[model samples]
Target: MKRRHFLQLTGATLAAVSLVQTARAAQPPATDAKAFRAMRKYANLSFGRIAYVDRGTGDAALFLHGAPLNSFQWRGAIDLLSPYRRCIAPDFMGLGYSEVPEHQALDARAQLEMLVALLDSLGIRAVDIVASDSGGAVAQLFVAHYPKRVRTLLLTNCDVEPNSPPPGIKPILDMARAGTLADMTAEWLTDRAKARATFGAAVFVNPAQLTDEIIDYYVQPLVSSPLRRSQYERYHLALTPNPLAGIESRLAHSTVPVRIVWGGSDTLFPQTDAAYLDRIFPRSQGVHVIPEAKLFFQEEYPSVIAAEARRVWGMR
Candidate 1:
């Protein structure tokens, strides 16, 4: 498998990128109200209709988001990186606007399979992967099973083997099992105030950063219907089992460069997990810990993600 070592951007490749920009000026805005609603697309993969956002033109950069959240989670990151890579953000089968069959298995392995099919459908063979939260767990699975498919990986606060389903997530997990997670999320959709007070505050550092549009984008689809609500519960419940189990050896031997950008304030995934990743990945690019940040810092800190992405892609 050929790796993306564009240590220096060639003039020929630059010309092609420039040509595309000239052909189609002003790509659709990704970080705005109409995102995931107006500009979103759907791919008819094996699982079902997979929702996604495709922007720019070049090599693909796949962005996988956390649970309860969809492709909207990466709007900020995509906004910055799209100019360089054809940024692709897909909502997993059970979450977001993806219309999945009720019978479809909503688990780690299933999610990985869906991604493979989705990429194949998109005619993209390889990608630079940027993943967050539970999406990070699925990203690990993708790297373990399909190592060559990934040129580079950028992971934010998420699950690692040592604490696969982090202790802090127990409450959410419990809510899922009791079938109350969906209702709670529905309430969040109905009462944005309650959501602003709890859900936003739990995931983000400053609750105010999670605007009404964000809350609506993240929560509405999850509980828009009975099927969506049930799938929402199942999605969280699937994480109860350690998804990253036994992949340590495969990851340790992986030649794919991985960068761990963790948040200091997220108790769900401690710094020790970051150290674990650094020790495990043979080509680990080192860790970047942002103080006072929380789990969804990827949304809050796009510049950090963009800079690191450029570094990993050898664009800088």
Candidate 2:
């Protein structure tokens, strides 16, 4: 079946399930602020002092953030999952407090190698990876090349196929490739409102959570450092056709258990891509779509995502 048609059917099925559960609905608990604060820390890795926080203990669970943002993106979800498993949220090179490299090697292979080296330096042999946005592509490369190192995989709202990127993304990719960092930032990156809307529109199942404070947290790192724009440009340039093509094919042959969690409201990649991914891994379970959520579903519906991760890891 076509991906769009599959998603439409899935949406209808989920809506029906929601109706059944409506009668028993109850309010979710408030997020724990103290726990969130406690989980915030930094780690020094090989490439640079890539900042990361490791909370709780037992199996290792690495949370890889998307473009523009860093480990801070996983704060809320880390709080929930930390109680049951060791959760590590690392700022990708050039993002967050991580030191930006002098050289321009931010592509998938370089980033994947950095991750592997970081894990080895930390003495961790294997981990369950939860990656979103650009990080999803990084995770795919890591698993494909180092399959035994990845215990499980969770991908959200990221596309590996060059032919299947969402409509407007191609233009942005082209812009990032051709333009200077200053031009890209002035023309696209620094707009606080646009950033909020772009990110909020992509991941949050609840639009109401796109508060000014949340937006500021996301935008702060980008603006705080002068290098942010250049770093982003280098990262974009690193995304070559070769690595992506290889990762796409490897995903089909992967033996590692995989789960796809998406926000139904995501217009960036669209929930339709979920079907394309499902076909690649037929043994993988069906995609789980959080209704009101957008691309950043992990931020908007962390508890739901946390629960799903626990299920995949067999922790609870």
Candidate 3:
């Protein structure tokens, strides 16, 4: 071939390659980090600096996560629901990305206090709460104490009066007290295989969904330092039935609309508790059961969570 022809062919090939590269670059990153990093915000509460995600606009939907996990648990649900309303997921003090000291006690009440302060900082008067596990306990306290501040309550597989620190997790508490839980947690954080075999397999219906990046997101804070591990232990040791007991009577009379989302396969918290809750909160719309799920069903079925939230909150 002639030199001129060869040069023309090379230039055309280079241009095509450049275009392909540009298109690939323009495609959005597939991870939750790519979608949510920009929404990160912080509220410097009395307890510590609380990291939270504030996304979209309109009325607020406050998301509270359970122990050993943080606002990261709600990312999938938030991503699904943010377009219709403001979504706020906070990192409980001593967990997630929050800037907190190790020794502070993070019982249900302290968590509740931090939550209220964070809400005040954001100037949010009321919210529709979607919570799970220990977060469900915290949500119950929030709605019961500050009835006016809550428009709706959504709870799934949470601690209730007489069942706080459900039986299935008792061994974990023993481990935490024995000083082995943190080390084991640290091991899981570094090893995806261990994380899947232990915590991930037990909690998630589909353990394969727990990606390495997401595992890092959940475990990084807990294993960040010795202080963090101590903080986690302290938080667990502080758990009791007292907080739920204090608010039990009040929940029955609460005028706020409530909904119970239960994981049917959850051996830890029985389905009977769902009925118990429905009876306590006469205002409850009724329980919605997800049969294939265990503990963290919200992660797997975020669309259902979003749908029920919209229906209850009167958001289309």
Candidate 4:
């Protein structure tokens, strides 16, 4: 073969191989409930037992999830970030796989206290927090009071200023107030079709991504029994009328560095809320609007969340 022809053929073969490799990498891994099921750990707090996912080792990264959801929301993000950081995701009292006590206060203040207790129990002194929705409100309260313990505060499509629960969540809250939340949630838990119509519509922008495993993870524990259902309602009712009103003063003076990532399409907590959050935190890095995302955007873009956490941690 001529030398030029031989070189061209070799290059073409290499390009073909590269393309094949890239294509393989682009395909997502198989989704399985077992693969994503985190090792459930428990912390015995004064209020109740807090179930959490404690994985990896190194600097701590605490993940706080929104209402009507739990630590499962942070599973994908933990899988990505756990390699370099100790990822801790806990189920707030009255939610998820955690033990729900009828006597405890499940409000933002109580949740914050429980968070401190959990970290203390884990012996985690300092952490970077990644919070979403109502969980963001809890984190805000934490960062303000425990500023020294939090290294970086990352907020995503969360409660801020004027829209604490946001309008989209009002209907759900209304149902909870009306004593119908348990029945509605139980219906969705048992019926995939109902879940598709309700949970899918309310929580996710891309319904196809709301796999059977994800639905089971969210609803099964809450609907497991009557006590759990009652606990769920109690938690919802525990929410204070103005959870963020008091936090505003502290947020304006927070020393911990802040970063905001908004799902550009999240009607529950829109970009306007993100903008308001950015303004309140004196040390905010700024807002990152993911145009194709919504409330559970971290699940859609775990890599982005992990990257930002690492960047803020100075590990990348």
Tens digit of per-residue lDDT, candidate 4, span 96-214? 88885767788888999999999999899999999988899889888888889999988888887688666666777788889889888878656887787666765566677777778
Q: TM-score of each candidate? A: 0.89, 0.80, 0.87, 0.88
Model 4 TM: 0.88
**Higher-lDDT candidate among 3 and 4?**
3
* Residue 205 local lDDT, model 1: 78
Q: Could you give the candidate ranking by TM-score, starting with the highest?
A: 1, 4, 3, 2
User: Which of candidates 1 and 4 is the stronger one according to TM-score?
Assistant: 1
Question: Candidate 2 clashing pairs?
Answer: 43-52, 202-294, 202-295, 203-294, 203-295, 203-296, 204-294, 205-292, 205-293
* C-alpha local distance difference test of each model: 0.83, 0.67, 0.78, 0.77
- Better model by lDDT, 2 or 3? 3
Better of 2 and 4 by lDDT: 4
Q: What is candidate 3's lDDT per residue for 1-316, written digit by digit as tens?
A: 3444334335533433443334323322232864565677888777888899998798899999987888878876787678877999998876778888656668888889889989899899999999998888889999878889998988888888878878788888898889887888878766898888778788888898888888887888887888888777777777754568767789979998876777888878888777678777857766666676788877766766766676567653
Q: How many backbone clashes can be found in candidate 2?
A: 9
Q: Which one wins on lDDT?
A: 1
Candidate 4: segments with Cα more than 4 A from true spot? 1-32, 36-38
Query: CA lDDT of 152 in candidate 3?
Result: 90
lDDT of 4 at 313: 70
Residue 67 of model 1 has an lDDT of 79
Candidate 2 whole-model C-alpha lDDT, 0 to 1 = 0.67
lDDT of 1 by residue, 11-35 (tens): 3234334433332233343478574
